[model samples]
Target: MRIAKVEAFWLRCPIPEAKQHRSDYGLLTAFDMTLVVITTESGLQGFGEAKAAVGSSGVCASIVSCVENELAPILIGQDARNINELWERMYNGVRDHYAIKRGRVFPILGNRGLTVSAMSGVDMALWDILGKSLNVPVVQLLGGAIRDRMEAYASGGWAGADAIGEQLLGYTAKGFKAIKMRVGVMDETVDYSIERVKAAREALGPDIKIMADAHGTFSVPEAKRFCRGVEDCNLYWMEEPISPDNKKGTAEVRAMTTIPIAAGESEFTRFNIRELIELSAVDVIQPDSAIMGGITESWRVAALAAAYQLELAPHCWGSALSFMAGVNIAFASPSAVVIEFSSGGNPMMYDLVEEQIQAVDGQILAPTDPGLGMTVNWDFVKEYKQ
Candidate 1:
């Protein structure tokens, strides 16, 4: 069918007090998400989310501007079935050009912040439309379910050492077998992270998995120190120990540490993913489906990961729409190790959707319904719309 309407809603969803978290970045503050709704000529509505982590300004407006002015005009009457073609059109439409220094050519697209974020929403909506039209779940369209249920890891917990006792107990109490906690927020030293992991391991025992996220906080040397120091903790992986773009630094950290490196949440497209893999930067790929041109590009990244023998544990940190998109990607890809479940302490996690994503005893059942397999609570979403 043909595309008829494309709309974007930007919302600033505040973190609930009970679920409030802190990290290296700062207090786990309000999150910004841009929801894209696409209405086909036949009146089918498909929803997608953009990973809209806003600054003081410009970001939310950019998301809306791109969809309304740049992309919608280009794809208004185009066939929604040509998902890839439309994706390329949108990807190529945005070009950052200037600095033409005597024969130097630079026409970049499908890379970086607002360009990819906006394109991601549109690309995702196309997949949702495609799935709804065919009456098949998005997972089926991707290649069918690879596993019966997805294993999810609880993410958060960087309040402090004093809070570790409470945090660890809370996670296990929810029956989460694996958990990831924030490090490097308190101090610039490795001592804090080492202690945090040690405490987590001590509380968790051997069977439960522990992962650490430095949030791209340390230098290469500091990362090496932290990873080696926490080696005894038997962490599942060390995430974003160094900056996301430092391929050489990441590779060096990976070489020195026995712990697996997981990154790419800050990365925007498959190109970024390719460079990371070619450099052997990470053991696991963490493509944020909402940010990286949606499920279509993430699936492409997953295929790339398979070729490199890498595991996909997608970086999930947004509304339920984005979370479910990540889940569907995990379901479809054989290389998936785990899909992050950030719903533990956040009501916004479940409030964004009408259907609940039930995770019992650390396992999540894959949704089998049509489209993205989750219904958006637009009314709730509208309440916080900017």
Candidate 2:
């Protein structure tokens, strides 16, 4: 089948009960998802979503434009069944040819990174098409699943100490064995943050696993102090204590704390992750399926982390589409420990998809449908077209 048409949709779903903490400065905004659809001449269609970062729809738009204009022509008559070959052809188009024009001239500006994200959306859609044609789920295409279900953790956005404690109990009661707490609201004192962690540990008791995220809000000294205070809280891990750019700072924090450090949500490709892993910067790897070069590069990142014996816990705070994409990676991955689920928005997540993935007794059921398996809500598509 030859190429027919490609379309891009940017959707902004509402967040009910938006709340903010002193640590986070940005608005606790609603769910915003960027959807990409590819149609083949034989009538088969594939769907993909890119996790739009804060105000990057325009970048995603450029990504789709490049796919439609530059890449689609090259693959018009190629067999879609050769998913790996197609992925290599598309990726090498940018890395081998485009990189010399972009990366060499203005390496600091990062145009190739943008191209990688765009290519990621297109590459994932191709895999979806391949899976559908073969009548198998994406997991099976990715060498079958390692587990039937993934254990999940509950996280609250802009939640206060009391609210977080109560939320932790709710998840605990629901049988969640682990939970993640959001921190680093640019606070100097960090006393309130420590108290929140202490309270969560107390409420959940000793057996439960707790992880803390600074969200790139803390400096080296600041993160050290904050992590030190909760040293005995029995945290499962600490995430993004410093900004992704400050490699030296991240390494310093990694060395200072005994708590396992995790990052890579902001990281894009295998090269970026290789630097982090080489420096011994983080104990865990968290790559967002929508953001970190989609499935192709993400699988490479998982393999890279496994070679280092590092854990993979992807940063997931997008629509059910992005979450399910992460779920597929988690299912096939052996190093992945837990998947993150947000308590930040209501109908925000539920309204964005046709059906929620089954989360029974704290574990998410593996999707059995061919490809990504979730239906795209076209009405929501029309509603949030930007």
Model-by-model lDDT, in order?
A: 0.79, 0.73
Question: Candidate 1 has what TM-score?
Answer: 0.93
lDDT of 2 by residue, 1-386 (tens): 55576665666655554333233645544556567677888889877766546221223466556667766775677776666565555666645455444553222223336556655666677777877878888888889889888888876624577777777787778777888877886434578778888888887889988988888878888889888999999789888898898977898998988999999988877778998988889999988766777788788898988899999887777666567677888889899868887655534356656876556777887769888876676787788766
Model 1 lDDT tens row, 231-309: 8889899988988768889999999888999988888888888899888898999888777888888998999988888
Task: Highest TM-score: give the candidate number.
Answer: 1
Cα deviation of 254, candidate 2, in Å: 1.3
Off by over 4 Å in 1: 54-59, 94-110, 343-348
Candidate 2 lowest-lDDT run of ten: 103-112
Clashing pairs in 2: 23-185
RMSD of each: 4.0, 3.6
Off by over 4 Å in 2: 18-25, 54-78, 92-112, 186-188, 346-348
